[model samples]
Target: MLSDDELLRYSRQILVQQIDVEGQLRLKQSRALIIGLGGLGSPVALYLAAAGVGELHLADFDTVDLTNLQRQIAHDTQSIGQSKVDSAMARLAAINPQIHLRAHRSALDADSLAAAVAAVDLVLDCSDNFATREAVNAACVAEGKPLVSGAAIRLEGQLSVFDPRRADSPCYHCLYGHGSEAELTCSEAGVVGPLVGLVGSLQALEALKLLAGFGEPLVGRLLLVDALGSRFRELRVKRDPACSVCGSAHG
Candidate 1:
């Protein structure tokens, strides 16, 4: 049951046949945990908040440094020295103060990470390091939660979603092998700001689709954006039977 103010707030989305009132209500009941409040996480948090996700659990141990201001649109110069979660909460609150905001100023460990993923309906892996990504993926797979993963380096970005609840979906380790290659992240490689925004927004879209139960979510497709070369390609990804995360029986 939508209140008068709720109807007005979500009128645009409700007008869409795919969404209507039901989808809007689903959005209001969704709880999303977003790890890493950096470039890729910025747009994801902003859009999800604006879309009215009932609760947001933001985890990031980093502070709002000057280097992050370029693409981390959720933070400003004033946010410097502030916890990333604090900065994100302020921005998300401004977007939709009606929602619940849970700010975690500390990094997520194994136990806390499990709790966060299990509590949320979905999780977003916005961390740059492969370690954090793997941790988030493992938690998602263990909890049978949908996970949205995105990344941007230099002028390239990639987006994918893995919902263990969906049998055909593949986890992150399925797409990217669990290798020990050193990652070239934005801080070291210098990313084009818009590229991060583009991919992060895509991550947000897939997350919203899953939350609202509308349209086909990006279950097993990897959408890549090569802004430098101005090329876009869709890569097919299949789950690994040997994947330790969501494989047949996790061995």
Candidate 2:
């Protein structure tokens, strides 16, 4: 049951016919894990926290650097050198004290990552690297959890959802079997701040839709954002039966 304050705080969201009181309650009971607290994770965490996702698990081993200020909105100048997880937790706590926040300050290895995914109802892969994305996808497939993945680099962004519980939905491995040999990080390629913010905000919206059972998620589609031209395109994606990570699990 929501407290009087919760009702008032989320009244605007609840008023939306698609996300009425029932959906708000569902949001209050869902637990989500957000991996990474950088550009994409920043907005993802903020919106989910504000929307009242009951428990949010924040995982990031990096620390705030001066360069992060341009895109990582969760941390400010005072947070330089502070752990990203700690910084994000502080920001999220301030946004909504009612929601629970968990921290994973250390880098998660295979076993730890599996454990983390197993503990959550859903996962948001705000991670930047291909390796981490593959690992998280494998973990989600093994744990039968839904994953909302988003990435932004330079002026381009992509967003998708993979639900292992659904037969037709493709896992990250299915989409990018072995990823690119030369994947670039934001620091290396440079990204526009608003590009990541846009992708992250979409990631958060997909999470809410999944958690609250309100709308269609990007389960079998990939949304591409071209910031330079301000164009949005979506491509249809399908599960790869031979996908090493999710093939046998789903089969």
Tens-place lDDT digits, model 2, residues 1-251 = 88899999999999999999999999999999999999999999999999999999999999999999999999999999999999999999999999999999999999999999999999999998999999999899999999999999999999999999999989999999898998898879999999999999999999999999988999999999999999999999999988888888866
lDDT of 2: 0.95
Can you write out model 1's per-residue Cα lDDT over 1-251, one digit (the tens) per residue? 67798789889888999989999999998899999888889999999998888999999999999989989999999999999999899889988888899887888899999998988899989898898899899888998899999988888888999988877788998887774787776768899889989989999999989999999888899988989888999998988887877887344
Candidate 2, pairs of clashing residues: none
Point out where model 1 deviates above 4 Å: 249-251
TM-score of each: 0.96, 0.99
Q: RMSD to native for every prediction?
A: 1.3, 0.7
Candidate 2: stretches off by over 4 Å: none
Q: After superposition, how far is residue 232 of candidate 1 from its true place, in Å?
A: 1.4
Worst lDDT run of 10 residues, candidate 2, spans: 242-251
Clashes of 1: 0
Q: Per-model C-alpha lDDT, please?
A: 0.89, 0.95
